[model samples]
Target: MRTDIELDESLMREAMTLTGLKTATAVVEAALRALVEQSQRHRALDKLAGIGWQGDLGVLRDPRSSDPE
Candidate 1:
């Protein structure tokens, strides 16, 4: 499929320098891959929920930040 869109020049330059990519398509591909990996990692963490953990307690403040009782 073919598409056209505007993108930041700095990102294009950085992508070329870092990935040796001379086109905007390569940068978009790399960014999409990173986003997918991060999403998968988030899913893995979500799957770990309820395995072992305690409920959150009330908020605690720093001793120095509160007046002494």
Candidate 2:
């Protein structure tokens, strides 16, 4: 898809410099990918935040130890 859109020159220049990306397309694609991945990670964290663990969490401290039955 080809589209023409106006972008902030200063921000673009800074991104190009910091990323060392030679082309606008590459820089934009990398930025978009990072944005999506970050959003996904945050969503996963939010879901995990609602979960509550029950029982002996101390088992996690020493997996080698066994409980007698």
Candidate 3:
């Protein structure tokens, strides 16, 4: 499946430079990777929310026990 879609020159240039990619395919691939990473982070947060984390969830914010790891 191949088709042509117009993209803004500024955006394309920015994406290429930011990703340091030589081809449009590379830029798109990097963008997709970032998207997947972001989605995974969101899913983790959603899972924590679903578990009713409240304030002190697994001592993430608070200090550990007197054992002091």
Q: lDDT value for candidate 3?
A: 0.79
Candidate 2's residue-wise lDDT over 1-69, tens digit each? 788978998999999999999988888999999999999999999989969878777776776767756
lDDT of 3 by residue, 15-57 (tens): 9988789988777778879999999999998878856535655
**C-alpha RMSD of each candidate structure in angstroms:** 7.9, 3.6, 4.4
- Model with the higher lDDT, candidate 2 or 3: 2
Return the top candidate by TM-score. 2
lDDT of each: 0.82, 0.89, 0.79
Model 1: pairs clashing at backbone N, Cα or C within 3 Å: none
Per-residue CA lDDT of model 1 for 1-69, tens digit only, reads 588889888878988899987778888988889999999999999999889966533424445655688
What shift in Å separates residue 27 of candidate 1 from its native position after superposition?
Answer: 1.1
Please report the candidate that would top lDDT against the real structure: 2
